[model samples]
Target: MLAKANRITSADDYRVIVRRGAKVAGAHTVSYLRSRESGTDARFGFIVSKKVGTAVRRNLVRRRLKAVCHEALGDGVCDVDVVVRALPSASAADWNEIRAEVLNALERRRARASIDAASQKGE
Candidate 1:
């Protein structure tokens, strides 16, 4: 489990990230990332819908996602809020597969941010 400080717990917070954040989609997961100016730690939220499976499978997917995010984020302090939503396919995915997908989504988000920054600077 992620530390409380590093977890997004409010519905409003999730809504803000989902509405205003940059998004990256993988085969089994979609990630939304929003950078904040005031926060000191990166926060993460997971969404495993009922469409993914029953209670047991949903919990399993959430746990796996949390582990993946912990490993990927490590102790990085970026003031970013991340929401990772698992698709139906995620229920069948292995840990490595889920990890890879989440990591890839994050990488894609980073790449897009850099490109956007460069373009803004060029303007």
Candidate 2:
């Protein structure tokens, strides 16, 4: 799990990121993110609501999400705050399935952002 400073906290922050951030959706989760100040460190947060299931189920979803985020973003992406929301299906999903979905989402998001940025600069 990431530290407090690394997590997106306030409602305002989440809203801002949702409005301006790049997003990638997976089968069991979605990651919304905004670039950070320094562009060298990455922060993360996970959300697993009661709608998912019991406390244990929610925790399991969060745990898997966290692990996937850590592995997917580890030192490769920089200076961003990412918020991951788990869907109900995630509560019972396997780790490898979750991991592949997450990694694919992150990769696709990165590729799209790169393309958009390049086009913006008229490259």
Candidate 3:
């Protein structure tokens, strides 16, 4: 489960992140990541729409995404807000696939951030 502090719950925050965050697309989900102040915890949000499936299936996908975010938090991601929007295919994707894709996207973000940091340092 995600701690309250680690979950994105405000409508405006979601709108901003979804609109302005860097996008990372996967086979089953699209993730938007935005940087926050370094002292803040990493926050996560999910959008599992009807296109994904019935309420039960949508909830299942949301739960899986949440668990993945929780696991990612344990891996030391912080100072970022990530909002994952489940694609229709996500309802059919197994947990392992979803996990792999989401993790890959997050890892890609880390790599990108590092390169950015290096570039800034070099300038």
TM-score, every prediction: 0.86, 0.80, 0.97
lDDT of 2 by residue, 35-105 (tens): 76665667677778888899989988888877777776564865667777788888878899888877776
For model 2, which pairs clash?
41-79
TM-score for candidate 3, please give it: 0.97
RMSD of 2: 2.3
Show where candidate 1 strays beyond 4 Å. Answer: 75-77, 115-123
| lDDT of all predictions | 0.87, 0.76, 0.94
Candidate 3: segments with Cα more than 4 A from true spot: none
lDDT of 3 by residue, 1-114 (tens): 899999999999999999999999999999999999878999999999999999999999999999999999999998899999999999999999999988988898889989
Q: Could you give the candidate ranking by lDDT, starting with the highest?
A: 3, 1, 2
| Most lDDT-accurate candidate | 3
Score candidate 2 by lDDT. 0.76
Residue-level lDDT of model 1, residues 72-120, one tens digit each, is: 6673536678999999999999999999987877777667767978999
